[model samples]
Target chain A: MVESRRRSGRLASVPTSRNVKVSAGLVALFVVVVAAVAILVGGGDDGSDAPSERASSTTTTATSETSADAATLPPVVTDDPRLLGAPGSSGVTFTEFLDFECEGCRAAYPAVEELRKAYAGRVTFNIRYFPLPGHQNSRPAAIAVEAASQQGKLEEMYRRMFETQAEWGEKRESQAGTFRGFAEDLGLDMKRYDAAVADPATLRRVESDFAAGSALGVQGTPTFFVNERRIDPRSVDDLRNEIDAAIAGS
Target chain B: MTAAPAGTSSDAGVRRLGLVLLLAGILGLAASAELAIEKFRLLEDPLYVPPCTLGGAVDCGSVMTSDQASAFGFPNPFLGLAGFAGVLVAGLAVASGARPGRWFWLVVQAGMAFAVVFVHWLIFQGLYRVGALCPFCIAVWVATIPAFWYVTLHNLQDVAARPSRLGAVARIARENHGIVLTVWLLLVAALLVERFWAPWDSVFA
Candidate 1:
C-alpha cells in the first residue's frame, strides 16, 4: 500500500503543461474574489463609522466629543462605591467607561482585574457604566450591576457580568431572568433585586455614566481614562505598562 | 510543452489547488495576525486605529468589539491562526507530491468543512448582527470556501472509494462545482447588499 502511494506521489513531480481552461477559470475566480474583497473592505461603515443622515444626527446630540481630550476629566461616577484598589486620595487613577454587555469590555475585564490586584492601594481603579445603545441588554445589565453595588457587592456583580457574558451579551433581547439568576446566586434579597432593577433612579444612574463617558469623547466601549488622560492599550501587558508608567511618573 | 498524460492532468489540478491554498493560507495567516495584533493595540489605545479599519462601514473596530468576534469565548483570529497554518502546511505537502490514502483526504474534507461553515456564520453575524465587515475575517472566508470546495471535488473524483449513489453525485458535482460555488458566493454577496442597502446607498448619495 505504501509503495503504491509513493509511486502515485512520484508521478506528480514530472513537468506538465498547465490546463488553459482551469487557468482561465481560476483567473476569473481570482478577479471575482478581488472584487468581493474591495466591496467588503472599502465599503459599508458600521454603526459608529457609517456616514449618513445618522452621523449628522449624532453630531447634533453627541456634544461629548470636545471635552474628552484634556487630562483634567472630572471624577466619573463620583459618590459611587464602584471604586477598587487605592483610596480616592491616590493620585494614579484608572477610570474605565464600560458597557456591561460589550464584548470588548468583557475581554478587558480580566486585565482590569489584574491591574487592580497589582496596583492595590497604589492605584485607584474606578469603573463607570456606559451602556451602549447598540447592545440590547447593556442598560439592564448596567442597572443590575449598579443595583448590586448598592448592596455592597458592586465589584462582585461587575466581575459576574464578564464571567457570565456569553449567556446574555449579544442576544437580541434582555436576559433579565439570567441576571436575576445571577443575583440569586449572589444571595441578594430577591425583593430588593427586583425593585432595584425596576427603579427609574437605577436607570438614571447608568444613563448618567453614559453621559459622562460621551462627554469624555468615548466613542467606543471599554475606553480607559488613566489619571485624566485618555489611554488606549491593546493588551493586558500594554495596560499594565501604561499603568506602570503613570504610577512611576506620579 | 508536450501534452501531458491523461492521469497527469488531475495531478496538475491538485497542484493548482494546492498552490492556491498555499497563497491564500499564507496571506490569510498574515492578515489574521495583523488583525489580532492591531486589536490588542486598539484595546490599549482607542486612538490608534488599524490601517485596515478605514473608518466608516469598513471599521475593524466595530466588528472586533462585537460579541461574535469572540464566538467561542475567545478571539476568532486565534482559530484563523491555527487553521491557516495547517492549510499552509497541507498545501506545501500536496505541492511536493505527497500522495496519501483516503484518510488524509477525509481529514482535509472535515477541516475545510468546519472552516467554511464557521466563516459563513461569521459573515452572517457581521452583516446582520455585528453590522460591520471585518476585513481579515473575510480573507479567511474566501480562502476557506474554495479550499473546502476543491477538497470536496478531489474526494469525489475517486469513484471506488465513494458509495454508489455518492459516486454519481460526485461526478455530477465535479463538473459543476465552479458554477455551484459562484452561485453560492453570489447569494452571500446579494445578502450583504440587501442587508447594508441603506449604508450602501448613502455612499453614492
Candidate 2:
C-alpha cells in the first residue's frame, strides 16, 4: 500500500522538462503533417480566393460575347423553356441548372419563384434539366416537366413538381405514374401527354441539358448563372444581390 | 514528497477531469437533444427544412435523412443522450470527491473509446457519403473528442507506471497529451477541408 501510494505521488509530478521537449517535437511534427495535407489536398492551389478570381475572369470574358469568347462561354440558354421574361430581352439573363428531385432545388423554389415575380421583366429566367444520377426519380421528373412544356404548361408543372417534391422525391421506384397524374391534373390531352412523356426525344432533351450542365462545370443542382457567370449564392439575398448587380451592369 | 500534498494534487486532477466531463456532457447533451428534435420534426414533415440547413455543403436535412444517420436502426442521437447522461452522473460523482474503483475507470475508458470511434465514423459518413455537415452534429463531435482524449489520458497515467511496452507508450502519450489531442483535432479539420474544398473555395472565391 505504501509503495503504491509513492508511485501515485510520482505519477502526479513526472518532471516537466522531458514533457516540454516532447511537446515541442510533437508540435513540429504536426506542422509537417499540416503542410503535407495542405499540399496533397490543395493540389498547388494557393487559397480559396483562386476560384473567385477564375470566376471573375470568366465573367469578364463572357460579357464581351466576342466570337473568340463564344467557344469558352457555356450555352446558358438553348431552346430551354423560359420561366420568366422573353428571348432577346434587353434585361439580364439568368439561367439555373436544376434537378426536380434535389432538396436544395426544392428548398430554393420559393425564393426563385419570388425572384421571378419581383424581377419579372428585368431578368430572363430559364431552367435547364440536370437530373443527378443519385436521385432515382430526377430523370423521370425532368422528362415529365419536358412533356408538360410541350403543352405550354411548363411553368405550372414546374411549380407543381417543387410543391409535391416531398411526396415523390428520393423514392427508389420510378415516379412516372405520379408525374402522369400531375399531367392529368393540368388538364392536358392524355394521348399527347403520354406520347410526349414516352418520346425518346424528350429523354434526349433532358440528357442534352445534363450534358450542357456538365460541360459548364455544374456539379450540383440549382447552380445559377447570371449573364453567363456561375454564381454560388448561399441565400435568396445573395441571389437577389447578384441579379441586382447584373441589372446595374447591363 | 508528503502523501498529503501528493493526494491533494491527485484530487485536484480528478476534480479538473470531472469539470471537463461535466462541461462536455452538458454541451453534447444539448446538441444531441436538438438533433433528435430536428430529426423527429423531419420525420413528421418531409418538407420541413431544418434551421441549420444552410443549403449546399452545410445542409443538416440531407445528413439527417441519410441511411448512416440511423446506423443502429435508430437515430444516433439516442446513444448520445444516454451516454452523455451517464457522463454527467459520473462527473458529478467524481467532482464530489467520490474516488471510483478501477472497474469504474475501465468502464469510462471503454465507453470513451467507443464514442471516439463512433464519432469518427460519423464524421467520415458526413464528409464523404452524406456530403453535408450538421452544425449540431459538429458540436457533438467537438465535445466528444476532447472528453475521449482526456479520459483516455487519465487512464493512461495509471498504466504509465509499469515497465512494459504498453506502459512506455502510455507514458509518452500521457506526457504529450495536449499535443496529441491538438494533432488529432487538426487532422479531422484537415479531412473536412479536403472533402469540402470545392464549396469552400467557391464561397471565398
Candidate 3:
C-alpha cells in the first residue's frame, strides 16, 4: 500500500512538472517576441531616433546664441573658391541641393533671392543640382545648367532656370530649343555650349553632385546648409542667428 | 479525478484573452508616442525623412512627404495617437471590472477592421506608389496587425463565452480569420517582390 501511494504521488507530480515546463517555455517565447519587436521599433542598430537628434541639436544650438555679445561683428564673406557669396558680403554659406523641376524648389527661389538681398555679401550661397528621376523634366534642366556653366554664364542660367521653370520643356526634345534660347540670352557661344551639354565630363559632374547630396542625406530639393551647418531658413531669425554664429566662429 | 467545471475553464480563457488585449493596447500606445515625436521632427525640418534609410530598398523621406502620410490634412500620426489612446482606455476599463455593453464590443470590432484596411492602403502606397518606408510608421503598422488579430480573436472568444450568436460567429470568424491573415501576408509578399526582386526595367516602367 505504501509503495502504491508513493507511485501515485510521483505520477501526479509529473503533470505539475510538465505544466511548469510549458509555462516557462511560453514565458520565454513571449520575452523573445517582445524583445524582437523592441529592436525593430527602435530603428537603427544604435537604437536612437535620428530625426529628433538632428532637430534637438539644432534647437539647442539656437538657444545658445543669446549668450553671445551683440557688439561683436560677424565675419565678412571671403572670396574662397568653395564659397559662393551673396551681394551683401555675408560670411555664411547657403548650400542648396536643388532639383530644377521641383515645384517647391521653384517656390523657394524668391525667398532665397530675398535672403541674398537681405544678407547680401554676409552670406555665400552655392547651388548643387539634385535632379530626381521621377520628375521627367528635371534631369534635362540640370544638363542645361551644366552647358551654361561651360560657357561661364552659370549664374545667369541658374536664375533663368528658376524664372522660366514653369515655361521650360519637361521633355528632352523641347529642352534643346530652351537651352539655345538661354545661351542666346546669356550671350554665350551657342554652338560650343550645346556641345558642352553633350560632353561626358559635364554629365558626370551632375551625377557626382547628386551622389554627394544623397550621401549628405539631402532627400529633397532646396536643402540648405548655412556656414557648413544645416539650417531651416523658414524659422524666424534661424538663418540670421546661424549666419551670425558662422561669422563669429570664422 | 477532479476535473474543473467547463464554465471555469471558459472563464480562464476569457481572463487570458483580456490580458493579451491589454498587452496589445500597451504596444499600440508605445507606437503612437514615437509617431508624435516624428510629427514634431517634420515641423522642424520639412525636408526631414524618417530613418527608413536601410538602403535604396527603404527610403522613409519619400513616403513621409507623400500626400498619403497626411491624408486628413494633418499628419497620420496624430490620428494614430488618438485612436490608440481610446483603445488603451477601453482596454483598461475592461480590465478594471467594467463590463462593456454589446455596442461597445461591436465598436471595438469595427475599429480593428478599419485599422486593418487602412494599413493595407498604406503598405500599397509605400510599396508601389510612394516608393519608400518610414521606420516608425512601419513599427506602427506592425504593432497594429497583431493588435487587430488578437482583438478579433478575443472578441469572437467573448461572443463564444456568451450563448447568443456564439455558435454562428465563432464558426464564421474561425473560417474567415485564416483567410484574412493569409491575404494580408500575401499582399505584403507582393510588395516585397515589387520593391526588391523586381527588375529596374519593369519597376520604373
Candidate 4:
C-alpha cells in the first residue's frame, strides 16, 4: 500500500501542461454560474416600470442644470417639520428622510440630535416621513408622530420613538398600542390624538413626504441631504464634515 | 530503493502546500488585524466610522456594531489573529522541509474546517440579517475558503490511496481540486449577487 501510494504521489507531482485548459475551464465555469444565478434570481421580476421611473427621477434630481426651475430641483425641505434652525436661513440646511421604525434611523438618532444641538444656529435640520413598506409599524409610527405634531409634540414623540425602538421594532404585528402609549406618556389629549391618528389627511401628509423623498432618490431610511445635495455618510464624522463644509461654503 | 525519488516529489508537494498556507496566512492575518483595530476603535467611540465603510449596503460600521461581530464574547478577529499566526508558523516549518505526521495535518484540517463554517455563518448574517457587507470581513472570507479547500484536498490525497467508497469519492475530489475550488467560490459569489440584487441593479441602472 505504501509503495503504491509513493508511486501515485510521484505521478501526481509531475506538473501537467493543462494549466491553460484549466484557466479557460474555470473562466467558462464562472460565466455559466453567474448567468445561471442571474436567471434564477432575476426570474421573479415582472419587469416593473418602478425602477426605471426611480432611475430617471434620480438622474433629474441629481443634475444641476442651467435653468434654476423649481421642478428641476429636488424638494429638499417641503412643509416637513423642522427639528432645528429655520427655513430661508443663511446657514446650511440638513434634511433627513427617515422612518421611525428603522433600526438605522434609531441608531442615527443620537448623533443627529447631538449635531442639531452643536450646529443649532448654523445648520437647519428638517425631518421628512419616509415609512418603508417592510416595517409593519413604520407607517403607524409615522402617523403617531404626525399626530403628536398636531398637538405641538413632534420633537418629543420623535425622540420617544427612537429611544424605545428596540421594544417595538421588527415585530410582525402592529405596534399602534405602543405608539399610543407614547402619546399618552406625553400627556396628549387622547381624543384629539386618536382623531389625528385616524385622520386620512394625516396619512396623506406622511405619504406626500415619502413621495417627495422618492422623487429626490431617497431609497433607504435615514437618507441625508445637505444644502439639497445627497450625502452618503459612513460615520458621524462624515456627516459633521459635510455640515462644516456646507457652512463654510455658505 | 524507489523511496528516495518518491520522498523528493512528496517533499516538493509539501513545499508547494506550505507556500500556499504561508500566503493565505499572511492575507488572513492582515485582514484580521485590520478588523481588530477597527473593532477596538469603534468600541472606543460609537460614532467613529470605520475606514472600510462606503455607506449604503457596504457599510462596515453597521457590521462592526452588530452582535455577531463579537460572537464568543470577544471580537472574532482575535480568533483570526491567533489562528492565522499558527498557520503562518506551521507553513514556515513545513516549507523549510518539516515532514509533520498525520496528527499535524488533522489538527490543521480541523482548524480550517471551523474557519470555513464560521465564515459561511458570518456571510449568511451579513447578507440576510445584518443587511450590509464589511469589506474587511469579505477579505477574511476570501482568504479562508481557498485555504480550507486546499488543506482538505491535501488531506484527501492520503484518504484516496485507500480502497473504499469514501476513498473513491476522495480520489475524484482530489483529482478535480481546481474545479471544486472554483465552483465553491462561484457559489458564494452567486449568493452575494442574488442577495444584494436590488443594490446591484440600482448601480447598473
lDDT of 2: 0.72
> What DockQ does candidate 1 score?
0.14
lDDT of each: 0.68, 0.72, 0.58, 0.73
Cα RMSD of all models vs. native, in order, equals: 8.1, 8.6, 12.0, 6.3
Q: Which model scores highest in DockQ? A: 4
Better of 1 and 3 by TM-score: 1
Worst 10 residues of 2 chain A by lDDT: A53-62
DockQ per candidate, 2 decimals: 0.14, 0.14, 0.11, 0.24
Identify the runs in model 2 with alpha carbons over 4 angstroms from their true place.
A1-74, A84-90, B1-20, B23-93, B96-129, B132-139, B145-205
Worst 10 residues of 3 chain B by lDDT: B1-10
Per-residue CA lDDT of candidate 4, range A1-250, in tens? Answer: 2433454556442222132256458778878877786667655643232211111111111111233455875578665554633443555788888888776677678888898888876777888988877567989999999999888888899899999988998788999999999999999999999999999999998988887777776777678888788887756888889988888888
Cα RMSD for candidate 1?
Answer: 8.1
lDDT of 3 at B196: 42
State the lDDT of candidate 2 residue by residue for B151-198, as single tens digits.
Answer: 776776656777888877876676556566667777788787666665
| Model 2, C-alpha of B146: deviation from truth (Å) | 7.1
Report the lDDT tens digits of candidate 1 across residue range A1-250. 2222243553322222123345446657766874675577655543343321111111112335557355665555476636753464457778888777766677667767777777888888888887777667888889999888878778888888889898877687768888888899998988998999999999998888887778777766678877667776544566677878887887
For residues B3-43, write the lDDT of model 3, one tens digit per residue.
Answer: 11112223333333355456656776676677677667655
Structural similarity to truth (TM-score) of each candidate: 0.65, 0.58, 0.55, 0.75
Q: Candidate 4 — which residues are off by over 4 angstroms?
A: A1-9, A13-24, A32-75, A78-93, A120-124, A226-250, B1-9, B37-75, B130-135, B154-158, B194-205
